[model samples]
Target: MASTRPLLLLVLCSLALADAHFKVFNLRGSSLSSSILGHADAYVKVFCGSATLGETSVRNNNPNPWWEEEFTHFKAQQNDVLRLEVHDSDFGFDDFLGVCQRQIKLGTNSHDCFLEKGGTLHYTYTLG
Candidate 1:
């Protein structure tokens, strides 16, 4: 009976701390011309809380870029802040374009928000 009690407690604890998985589908709008030449090679950086999630492929010479990228199996909790930053790719240093942030909440969600400087970013989140 004592052994069964421990096992049952373990099962309950596992269920309590079970991580949640979600998908973030993002699309970005035109960024202001920041390239030294004229057009910008832009990409996005995603962050969950303070941890770096991942970056999208660079869209060269396009101020307006559409990313069908999916962040699958991302671990997050309720009320966590998800941030996105737009940057222009460069040889030595990347130029910062804009940023957007949103808070995670219960249920499936979708948001269309503007970036920091110039441009718009939209996100569709599916929670599991």
Candidate 2:
């Protein structure tokens, strides 16, 4: 009976920590900062904790960049923190535009993160 109790508890804990699918899509930016020459070459990186989920392709010379892309993390956990970073693809060092961090939640989630430097990033995500 004692051994069976431990086994049942382990099964319950495993179920509690089961993996969930996470998807981030419809990522767009508005009124982003322009470079000295002209508009910014923008791209985005999506992360779950230290793991890199995916990255968007760079949109050159566009203040308003819309990425028709989706990033998915198949083994995401509910307690994980999601980090979205916007960057300018420059010649030498890439410029850090802004970043948004949010706790993972179940169901659909949306955020209109105001960038640190200048701009707004709109994105929608789902966890199931």
Candidate 3:
């Protein structure tokens, strides 16, 4: 059986729900040391393809802070890995930190993807 990360990005290719997303969390971490689940106090924006799926603005009901506003209602294909581009509030794209290991439902149909409840999927890049 294939691990969930790579499969997340590939699953979308078969289904054309929308082309509004681009990057996928490609950080392949199946253990604790390589997850992207942490806290950042910066303001940023998330792009789905060319469309702004997440922002610190009121339009998307963003509560500010990059993390909270970004992953809200976010969805992913079976193995769609999102390349996370972290940016500064007043600056441009800065770095690629981590990835979101999806934990959706068994019968999930919507584009809305979220980590499973109590299901551990680390979204980190590296552990040092």
Candidate 4:
């Protein structure tokens, strides 16, 4: 079966060459943030129409750090709905580094709701 992580990465890489419709963020390293470097715990949910395609948590190595969750191979599909949501309500306001550009995928409804202003997250997906 086609892996989800590789697929998402491919979509993200292509987004760079296209014209940005929304202009989510300019490529720049932001200054120091006020939040305490908060981390966002997110999961991947795949859906198509009203049916749930699948769901998987971004596995982690250490729970305390919570920033190094490797998303190299996400489990997803073409018509599935994917949502990366902060799992912990408490960590929403904690210190957070901008998401790694290498790990972003601009799929349908793909977006990163970075708290405050430190990183930019957006995606453009073309479904078949």
The digit string of per-residue lDDT tens for model 3 on 1-128 reads 76898787778754655322323222211211212333222333444323354543311222122232324233433333333333222224433223333333323222322222211222322110
Cα lDDT for residue 14, model 1?
Answer: 76
Q: What's the residue-level lDDT of 19 in candidate 4?
A: 30
Candidate 4 wrongly placed segments (more than 4 Å)? 1-38, 59-86, 89-121
Q: Tens digit of lDDT per residue, candidate 1, span 1-128?
A: 25688889999987755657766786666554655587778888888776787899998888777887887555677677878788888999998877878877756887876756566666777665
Q: Each candidate: what lDDT?
A: 0.75, 0.91, 0.31, 0.33
Pick by lDDT: 3 or 4, better one: 4
- Which predicted model would earn the best TM-score? 2
TM-score of each: 0.76, 0.86, 0.26, 0.26
Candidate number with the higher lDDT (1 or 3): 1
Candidate 2 TM-score versus the reference: 0.86
In model 4, how large is the Cα lDDT of residue 34? 29
